[model samples]
Target: MLYLTINETNALLRTAHTDAFHLEVSDDHSAVADETEPMRRVLAGLPPFEPDAYPDSWREWDELVGEVTAHGVTMRRVRVVSEPLTDYVRFLQGLTDRNVRLGEDIRWLPRHLVDQADYTTDEWWLIDNARVAFTIFGTDGDFVGAALTEDPAIVDRCTGIRDALWRKATPHADYAPGG
Candidate 1:
């Protein structure tokens, strides 16, 4: 039940020292949006829903992912979103190509369809199937902190959900935001 600042959470995740990193995101938009300057500029420059307008400035992120993958660290992310996606979700979908290129296995699951699956209501990361981190936010939807735990029961539950959602989710390349 340790409440951690966003920076602290990031540091913990970055230092995971694991062979696999898995993440489940339930938010329409993350509070700490991608801060890389090139990504920032491209997102700012695009029109509302430009499908083919991927900016070519994600080198930093891509390279970091390349290094991680090269070291045999498998990374995956699954997002649960509602129909009629929010602008932020749409924006995130637009960025999936970059994610895919960076060696992340990404998936999207429509929210209404998760009726009977093991689920987590909050956003979390299940690292190496051993640790679970729930990211917490403030009232105004600003980035606040995260709670990290190594309880086996908790980890097992989250891992179950991750596996179930992964089975149900749409691959990034085939998923459409409003479909």
Candidate 2:
């Protein structure tokens, strides 16, 4: 595992091929998530999700997914969890065409883990397993701060959290907040 400050993480995300994104939103009003949209697009290499429709930017995201798949990368797994359903739903519903994702392959973990996350402020930890990229964000609406690293410990912990989430999450579609 490598240790990268926020800036380094952003850089890696730019070139990361296959990633396992573990995005956590501690705040009900997620400002950090908004700021990282560009990073998301770069890592995903897809257009934004269009809110007007269900699979608004399905093909574009699919193209990106296809690219990863071609690299023998399975679906780029993003384990995002926010506060109350109202908050989480608002966050999910606000996604654009490229960002919008159906529960098809996503896993919804128990919300209790939100309290278990190691952080003092609202943050996001995006782990690119293939590239071994780990990125973190600390922010309030317009003011955002971040850290990025490649430490094996960071990688392992992120992987561990993902594993826990996978084991705890209900199948994506059936996910109901607070359960």
Candidate 3:
């Protein structure tokens, strides 16, 4: 099992060829440093974070998504969230349009509709159907590191999970976080 720093994972993402699918099971990644200020702003009822005001890493990510999508890579994310929405999930919901605008497909899956035993608990990014990068979060839900695996079994399982959940998830434009 090889581990990758966040930067390393980003680099790998930049190298993607066909598709990049992300599965997020956590309701809160608020402890992530880049998210703190935005989460606070959201909680305070401020308008969504402006693109120009995004954290440096986030801005870079947005750029990367735009670049990759322009080159024909399909990027998709499915977030499995519990409702009534957590503050952090609400925050993400507010910001999802920007991701969609950048050409990434984002979806939401209500937790109640999913059977826990049928899926992996960890959040992961499966790239080009070949590599899987599992995100590791601290106990407090802070971003830690990632484990990258190319083992066929792990990649296959993640692919299956992503496909099944994606079919059942609601597209960003159709998802109503508060409802």
Cα deviation at 33, candidate 2, in Å, is 9.7
* Top-scoring candidate (lDDT): 3
Expressed as tens digits, the lDDT of each residue in 1-179 for candidate 2 is 45665445444444545554544434344354443553344336444343553242335445554444455433434344554555434445334223324212455544556447532232444445533443333444442335455567656766666665556665544655652
- The per-residue C-alpha lDDT of model 2 at residue 51 equals 51
Better of 1 and 3 by lDDT: 3
- How many clashes in each candidate? 0, 22, 0
Show pairs that collide, candidate 1: none
Show model 1 residue runs off by greater than 4 Å: 17-27, 30-64
Give the per-residue lDDT of model 3 (tens digit) for 65-103. Answer: 988898899999999999999988988988888799998
How many Å off is the CA of 132 in candidate 2?
5.6
lDDT score, candidate 1, position 143: 57
Worst 10 residues of 3 by lDDT: 47-56
Measured by C-alpha RMSD in angstroms, how accurate is candidate 1? Answer: 4.9
The better-scoring model by TM-score among 1 and 3 is 3
TM-score, model 3 to reference: 0.91
